[model samples]
Target: MALIGIISRELGNLTFLVSLDLGSNKFHGNLPQEMANLHRLKVLDLSFNSFSGEVPSWFGFLHQLQALNLGNNSFTGSIPSSFYNMPKLETLNLKFNSIEGQIPKVIGSLINLRVLNLIGNKLVGFIPTSLSNASRLETLEISYN
Candidate 1:
């Protein structure tokens, strides 16, 4: 249910705030680390794909990013801790991946956070107190009791 004929370039002329939805596809292989070049990316959806490997750390470089979806992929590894630097990030949907490790205390850095869904993953450790500081937070779904 997977193949590699994916649209591999979006940065050639993309400038304005952009949104991409490539969910429910049969894409296989790593998410191209080139997305960070879309410095103006405001929303991105890559859910329900066959993407493997670690999510690139450069995602934190997208200062204009407002929402991001990397759910239901085969991504394996700890979430890049640098994600806390995206000061404008509002909605983050990373619900179903192979992501392990504690939700970093840095998540509190996302002051504009509305939804933080890390539910149904292999994460472990105590919930970080930093998350509570997000007064704007609307939802936090992680399977840890």
Candidate 2:
């Protein structure tokens, strides 16, 4: 069974943490804002959970993050523009959620991104052409909108 309940700020104190896999859990409620304290986090996978509320803008504080998977959750609201703050971000998976609104143009600024998945959401508006700026992009999935 998946672990349930809100995450704790104690996790943020693990300053040396490079990767965190909390996917496939029963965890619910808004993500801990203190997660922004994980400065060295490189890969954060919190997919396949019950997490709700807007993806926190403080996530931008994790500058070293590379791959982030928050797919298959109950998260709502538009993707935060602050996401662009992570210049080293490579894979971004926010598929299978209730998130809406246009794909932010700032996404193109994530030049290091290799995989981009936003499938199965309520998003509207034309796909941003600036995505072309992501020279390293190998896979772009936006199906099942």
Candidate 3:
């Protein structure tokens, strides 16, 4: 059977973790805030699960995060502004969720970002012009909102 239930707070004990992919599983519930302790994390994929609640803003603390995939889940609420603080972030995927509100202009601050996918959300408003500031951005998919 697929892994199910909330992630344990004990996961934060792995301070040396570099990558964690719990995607395409049946796991549900809010992400444990304790995960903020994973200071060395680089890749985190929690897609295609039943996870519900506002996307955690503490993700900004993961300074080493390069790729983040929280797509195909049940998250709701506007995109967290803290996400713009992750300087090393390259890929951000939040497709097929219940996220709402306009894409913040601060998103352009992720100078190293390469791929950004936001398809199938409840977002509204024109794509921000400041997105042009992300000079390194290569792929942008924001259709089907």
Instruction: Kindly give the stretch of ten consecutive residues in candidate 3 with the minimal lDDT sum.
Output: 1-10
Q: What would the per-residue lDDT of candidate 2 be over residues 73-120, giving only the tens digit for each residue?
A: 999999999999999999999999999999999999999999999999
lDDT of each: 0.81, 0.94, 0.94
Off by over 4 Å in 3: none
lDDT tens digits by residue: candidate 1, 1-145: 3434554656424656478777878876776666667788888888888888887788898888899898888777887888987999999988888888878888898999999988778899888898888889998888731
Residue lDDT tens for model 3, 26-104: 9999999999999999999999999999999999899899999999999999999899878999999999999999998
Question: Which runs in model 1 stand beyond 4 Å of their true positions?
Answer: 1-13
Q: List TM-scores for all candidates, in order.
A: 0.89, 0.97, 0.97
lDDT sort, best first: 3, 2, 1
**Global lDDT for candidate 2?**
0.94
Worst 10 residues of 2 by lDDT: 1-10
Ranking by TM-score: 3, 2, 1
The TM-score measured for candidate 2 stands at 0.97
